[model samples]
Target: MIISNIAAPLLGLVDTAIIGHLPQSIYLSGVALGAMITSFTYLLCMFLRMTTTAEIAHAFGARRSDLAQQTTTHAVVIAAVLGLAIILLRPVILQLAWAVIEPDPELQRYASQYIDIRLWAAPAALINLVVLGILLGRQQAKYAMGLVIFTNAVNVVADIILIIGLDLNVVGAAWASVLAETSTAALGLWLIRDLLPPWRQWHITPAYFKQFGAMNRDVFIRSLLLQFCMAVMTGYAARFGAVTVAANAVLMQFLMLISLGLDGIAYAIEALLGAARGQGSRHKIRLWMRLCALWSLLFACAYSVVFWGFGDGIIRLLTDLPEVIQTAKLYLPWLIIMPLLGHWSYYFDGVYIGLGLTRAMRNTMAISVLGVFVPTWLISQQWLAEEHANHGLWLALSLFLLARGVTQWFYLKRHQRRLST
Candidate 1:
């Protein structure tokens, strides 16, 4: 799981590295914003992954082979449909995304180049999400790792050839990603052939379908809230001008690398926690939570040190633009603080989801977004309205992290109490 999750972000790292050396910094920055918008869109549909994992894991644990099969089928079908819908809504999504950033005409043109080309990969990307979820559910960690490695490897190679060699610019970078993801989706589906039953025998039972639908709904809502926060974060970053936005984009890539790396641990927690819950071992749940928290904090501290120590060099590697480097250096401290406060919520999210506590997760996220995240963002915007808009953006984001950790802790305690009773 660790390798699988890590590989995906390494792909992005490679992309960033290549683009960082591009002749124009604007192209790099445009790719960053464009990537964020695309990522935000894909993340909004992430329930295809999360809900499928929980449903398939539970079904398999309960010894219901038919239900397990149906879960995978339903996930693929729904993901396909949703992906098509996103493609159809591409113009609308692009319009809204542009409204948020409102970049200059040239950068906007580049962003559109990236977004429009990448939109074609929507169905493949979403299906890949479902395939990953199904693999994790079946405890096929190695398979998942292989798929991610293969996908990212192709992406890196393609990115090099297209962006550097062919000089297709942003469009090359975007198309590289699309091709890699599409290949991954195809390969992942093929790899799961043995696990799936024959097509003729497949049918969704009403009871299993209802359960699957509810899980999907919960995860969909939870993911929406999560993605909304990310969209706002990206949008806010863009308001600070191209240099600021680019710096934030570089910093965010690093943050995501940390977050997703830690997620490998969380993914382990989710798998083990789900297994423990299946066995009705309440004590195991507590144990998993404690271990996850302990490990997360340790890793967070380690990440903080690495980023603090080598951040300047890292930023330099990403871009040669003096302003982008200078701005990213200014923001380095917050990058250090982020993992310390942010890692907990991610771990808790996995634990709760593994326990099938989606309602609590959803409700807490709702409160965090409305009560904590949005208000802090607005306040920060007002406070830094004249100069230093990025300051407000970072502060508001920090508050959002604090809110997530606090709220999730509250609900997790309540969950423990219920389990005890």
Candidate 2:
């Protein structure tokens, strides 16, 4: 799970690495802002993966192959609809992002170059989510990890050939992602042959639709709120100019690395807890919970130490631009403590998914994003100078993460008697 999770973020880092070295910072900034918009649009269907994993894990534990098949079919359909919706409404989406981000013309052009080509894979990307969800739900971590490794491996090679050899710039990066996503989705579907039934056997009933939607509803909103917060962070960073946004782009890749690496812990617990729930073993559930928390804390501490020690070296590896490098190092403290501050939210998100407590998950995220994140950033803005505004953004983001864990902990405490008994 950790290897798989880490590979996913390396895709972003690779994009950052290649684009960050271009003659101008706008290329990196464009992709940064463009990727933010892409994430916002495509990851809206993130619930396809989350709910699919939990529900399928529970079904797997209960030995319900039929249910798992049905869940996968439903997720595929939902993904198709949402992906198509994105492709159709992309212009409107871009307009909305422009209103909020107000990126300069050159940055916007680079961003548009990325966005226009990248979004064509919306269906493929979302389907891959379901493919991964199904793989993880069955506790087939090796295969799940293999799929991601294959995808990113393909992406890396394509990035090198197009960006370096062909000089396609941001368009090259975008195309590389498209090819990777579409091909990986195909490979994933084929690899799940054991789970895939005959065409005649696949059918979705009304009950399945209702159940799927119910499972997806809360987590759907949670994914959106989370993405919105990130988009806000990137959008605000863009306000500081191309150099600042480019520095942020590089820093955000590291942040993605931290978040996704910890997410491996979350993914593990999600599967383990769902299986425990299905088997009606509170002991196993609580046991996995404790272990997940302990391991995650250790991992978080290691990240903080690593960033504190070697972060500058890693930053230099990503981009050689003197201005961007200096600017990125200016905010090293936030990246250093980010894992420690943010790991809990990522961990508990898995707990909620596994326990079928996604409503509570959504509630905490609502409080974190709407109640804590935006307000903290807004309030800090009044006192923060323009040069230090990014710091304020990081502070709000850190507090938002802290607030999620705190609220989710209280909710779990309130329900402990029922849950444990």
RMSD of each: 1.7, 1.3
For 1-421, candidate 1 gives per-residue lDDT tens digits of: 7677764456556777788787677887778878878888888787778777776666656667766677777788788888899899999999998877687778788888898888888999899988988887777889999998898889988998999899898989899999898999999989877656777876667886787788778778888888788766656676667877788888878777786768877777777777676667778878987888898888888988888898888888878878788888888888888888788888887887788888888888889888988887787777775566677777777778778889999988886788679
Best by TM-score: 2
Q: How many clashes in candidate 1?
A: 0
lDDT of 1 at 29: 77
Per-residue lDDT over 240-280 for candidate 2, one digit per residue giving the tens place of the 0 to 100 score: 89888888888888788787768989999999999998888
lDDT of 2 at 48: 90
Per-candidate TM-score against the hidden true structure: 0.95, 0.97
Model 1 — which ten-residue stretch has the worst lDDT? 6-15
- List candidate 2 segments past 4 Å from native: none
Off by over 4 Å in 1: none
What TM-score, to 2 decimals, does candidate 2 have?
Answer: 0.97
